[model samples]
Target: MTLAETLQTKLGEWKPAGDGRHSWAETFADSGWAVRIEADRTDTLGCQVWEVALDRVGQADASLTLSAWADRIAASVTGLPEKLKVVEIDQHQSAALLRSDTPGSRGNDVLYFEVRLAGLAKASIRRFKSEHAIGARREQIPFIITHEGLAKVVGDIAG
Candidate 1:
């Protein structure tokens, strides 16, 4: 399934809808939820390259910063509900690279060009509120990026 569809399933009730190039939105209750992923591409020798970094999510989430990543695994799954965990991760060289502690296992890894987010439980959202602030902005819900969508964003032919 595509990223949009995967989000739809994971969210239980939120419907996925696209609003712009690589931008999507969903409606629930009276609020509208959405996210967008944009990557800069450089062409050399007829190949296109893509990248996404933890710094980018840091910029968006406002909880991750140069000083905050001393413990990556803790930070990766921190400040949120217990059930909605950050199961897999993929980071760019620009951002601290996070890999599985268990070796020889490969699946559900995110690449540079995508940010995957998923988690829910109204009470969870309420309890987690007022805890995340990376900059001047505040956030209650985290973005969910899907593994399959990560591949599809940069295209199956390339990373």
Candidate 2:
């Protein structure tokens, strides 16, 4: 099966978290396994948030590691918008770190940026919004891809 088709099929078996804050999805390919297309909304430090995670399995001797996939994914996502400036890039044994500056958050007050994951066949993306705090209005913004989305993107690249 194609990668996208496999992903769609895997997504169907997901189970929701009891708190209504998270869900898990899974998929299997001829060689690899993908898991946890988690989606959720919540509040953090008075800020609205959302998140998603996608992970891959079976990497005993794969040619493309998660970290390499993350690098390609980062390049793809960052290329989406010029305003999304990459702030930091780091990598560990099996993971990659990406920090970026987003557009203004909360009615042009504070801006939003996130540190997303982009290594490992299984990846995730999380988002964050920060208000300027100087007469700025509070906004119920979506979750920033802090780590979850990065994981998925990396997986996509590797696949």
lDDT of 2 by residue, 1-159 (tens): 555445444444443445655654555555365655445532221212354455556663557654555455556654222234344445554445554544554564554544354555445555544566565564433543423333334345445
Task: Write the residue-wise lDDT of candidate 1 on 38-125 in tens digits.
Answer: 3222111111112221111112234543223323333343221121223343243223222222222114322111123221101011
Q: Which candidate tops TM-score?
A: 2
Candidate with best lDDT: 2
- What clash count does candidate 2 reach? 27
Distance from true position, residue 23, model 1, in Å? 7.9
Model 1 residue 156 lDDT?
Answer: 17
Error of 1 at 66 (Å): 2.8
